[model samples]
Structure formats: structure tokens, C-alpha cells
Target: MPAPPPHSAGIPASRRAQIGAGLSDSLGVGLGIFPLGIALGVLVVQAGLPWWVSPALAIGVFAGSVELLLVGMLAAATPLVTIAVTVLAVNFRHVFYALSFPITRVRPGLPRAYSVYAMVDEAYATYALMPAEKLSSARMVTGQLAMQLYWVGGGLLGVWVAGALPAPIEGFEFALVALFIVMTLDALRSKREVPSALLAGLAAAVALIAFPQQALLAALIMFTAGLALRYAVTRGAAHA
Candidate 1:
């Protein structure tokens, strides 16, 4: 068979289409991410950090909530050991996310590496609900790249806005909480995983009460154990 013709831009037509579709898929998520990125930038400036720190975090960390937390920690001059532990505790969930992410669809080499590196929560959620047949390396990578662009662009814009403002804004830090709440609500609506949600809440409450100093780490551990036990029982019942 003859090879497919190239797009006017010199890329293969099919490749171009895949890239376009990926960008289109990212549009909705980008809308949400952009504002949060802006918030991060504003927070950085308000915290008295250099304007460049916003894009640096966006690129280096790429974890929204963690970046926000880091801003506060950096401003407070948090100890290195504590910061390291907190970052690990906060991002440990990504280890689980990797287990189910469709990384096999991507080609090996730099493409696969980039796909793995860019597998943020938004990308994971987007792919989890996507039909398996529709997945492709180009689409996944392009979508991730587009989301990052939104974040970087928003950060720059926000820096400009913050510089123009007369005074620092209060309550901008709440954007992190607001984003998570929206994500949680959306997940509930889509999967109706009420039991899992309830378990998470219980774990958080217990951890807060019992291990206040280590609440985040303790809650994550408890939640993971609860999920494992639930799965084992459910599987055994099915077999029985």
C-alpha cells in the first residue's frame, strides 16, 4: 500500500488529526488548570517569591496541590527534611495511579518517558474514562503537552496581573482546596463510588484525631489498607 500523504504542515495527515484531537480533548481540562496556574502565580508573588518561581514550579513539580503547599513552605522557610517527607507523602498516590495508567499505548524511548513523566491526575482521570479502543500515543502525549502549556501560559499571565495589582490578594490559597473539591465532586458524579468516598472521609477523620502531626501521611496509609481489605473481601465473596 502507498504511504499516506503528509499534512500541509508536513506532518502525516493521520498524525496531525491525532494531535488535533488530543488538543481538543485537553480544552476542558485546560480551562480548569489555567485558572489554578494563575492562582499559583499570584500566590508566589503574594508570598514574596520571585516571579520566575511560578513557571519553575509549574515545570519542575507539575503537581498543582503540592506546588501550592511548597509555596507556603518555602515562604515559611520549612526545613529540607520536612519538605522532602511532605512531598513524598503528598505524591505517593501517583504510584498507584501509574499501576492503571495506559502507558503501553505509547511508543518506547522519549515518548514513553515523557508520557510517564506527564501522567498527572488530570491525565489519569481523562484516560481512565476514555474508551480503550480510542487510545493512542500521539493523542495522550499531545493532550498532556497541551495541559502543561495552559499551566505555563496562565502562570505568566498571572505574574503580569500580580505585578499590576496594588496589593496582594487574600484567600487565593483557597484555590487548592476548591480545585480538589471540584475534582472529588466530579468523581462522585461519574463513578458514584460512595463507599470509597466514605472510606476516605473516615480515614481522614481518624488520622486527624489520632495522628495530628502526621495526618496526611497517616490518612493515606489507612485509606490504602482499607481499600486493600475491601478488595480482598469482595474478591473472595465472588469466588465463593
Candidate 2:
């Protein structure tokens, strides 16, 4: 008889299927992530940082937008406190992401810790839209691992590519903005999310006008409050 299929050796078919689905789900987001990772690596090198910084940020920081910002900050020799605050402001949205992320599905221990550590935007968005019954620890962790691999691998490649270039590439910094725009557009695809998007725009405009010095933090606070109020009203109406 022929050798048994891979899944039949030890792993259950259901688990193997879940792992496959997870990796499959990561592909679409990985396309965007990999390119952005390349941009980040190129940025680190062009900023006069060591090549190792590329993969360092990819593996250590692992937050794309924050990593991009860190490159410029580190190049300018920004103060540690300033860097810390900026990172907190930029990544504070992750706190909100955690509210709805199905992290509890992951088993406790190293697996759960890794899942939490790797909970990037792409993973959050993917899990948010997935049906509950279809979710499993294997799928969620596998998908996140795949996305991170893409980012890490892309960063390494970018470092090499940047080294070969005779001159630095301009506008790699815009990659972070582009990534957010794509995410916003994807989120807005649902009709129900339109109101929230509008609220975010309004918050951003008001913050820019009234708190230009702290626009990002201000906008996040305003948008979060708006979401909370909207939720309360909707809940009340439902109960009424």
C-alpha cells in the first residue's frame, strides 16, 4: 500500500483542514503585508540604520505602521520617552481590536501568547468576519504565523534589494498610510460600517482643526467615544 497521507499519520483530518483554511485566509492579506514589509526594510536601510534593523523590527516590534515610524525616529535619535508615547498612540487601536478579536479560541500557554503577540490588523480583520463555528485555535494561529512569515521574509529580501540599489528610494514612508487606506476601504465594504467610517472622518477633521498638535491621539479618543455612544443608542433602541 502507498504511504499514508500526511494528516493520517498523527494529526486529525479536522485539524489539518483548519490549518489549511487558516493559511488560505492569510494569502489575501499577505499580499499587502509582504510589500509593506519590503518598504519598511528599504526604509530602515535608506535611513542609515544597519541592515539587521529590518528583521529586528519585523520580529521584535511586528507592528507595520509603528515599525515604519520607528525607522525615522531612530534615525533622528528621538528621545526614548517620545518614541514610547508615539508608539502607544499609534498602536492604541489594538486595544479596541482586542475587544472583538476571538483570542479566547486559542488554547492557553505559548500558543495563546504567540497568538496575542502576533495579533496584527490583518489577522484581526480576517477573524472578525469569519463565522464563529468555523473558527479554531489551529486555524487562527496558523494564519497569523503565515502572515508574519510573509512580513519577515519580505523584510529580509528588501534589505538585500536596497543594498544593491545605487540610490535610495523616496516615498517608502507612505506605505503605512497606504496600508491604512486599504484597510479602511475593506472595512467600509459593509453597509453597516459606513456610519462608523463617517464618524471616524468627522473625528479626524475635528481633531485636526482643534488639536493639531495631538491630532492622532485626539482623533482616536473622539472616534472611540463616538463608537461607544453609537453602541449605547443602538442597544437602547433594540431594547425599546
Could you tell me the lDDT of residue 12 within candidate 2? 94
Query: What TM-score would each prediction reach against the true structure?
Result: 0.76, 0.73
Task: List per-candidate RMSD values in Å.
Answer: 4.4, 4.7
Off by over 4 Å in 1: 1-6, 177-240
The pairs that clash in candidate 1 are none
Each candidate structure's count of clashing pairs: 0, 0
TM-score (C-alpha, index-matched) for candidate 1: 0.76
Worst 10 residues of 2 by lDDT: 171-180
Model 2 lDDT tens row, 81-181: 66777788778888888889998899899889999999888999999778899899999999999999999999888898899999887876676677679
| lDDT, model 1, position 99 | 88
lDDT of 1 by residue, 1-240 (tens): 999665586888778888888899899999889988888888889889999999999999887678888888889777676677778877888899888999988889998898888888889988867887888889999999899889988998888889999987888777778867886897788564777888899999999999887676678778888989989998999999
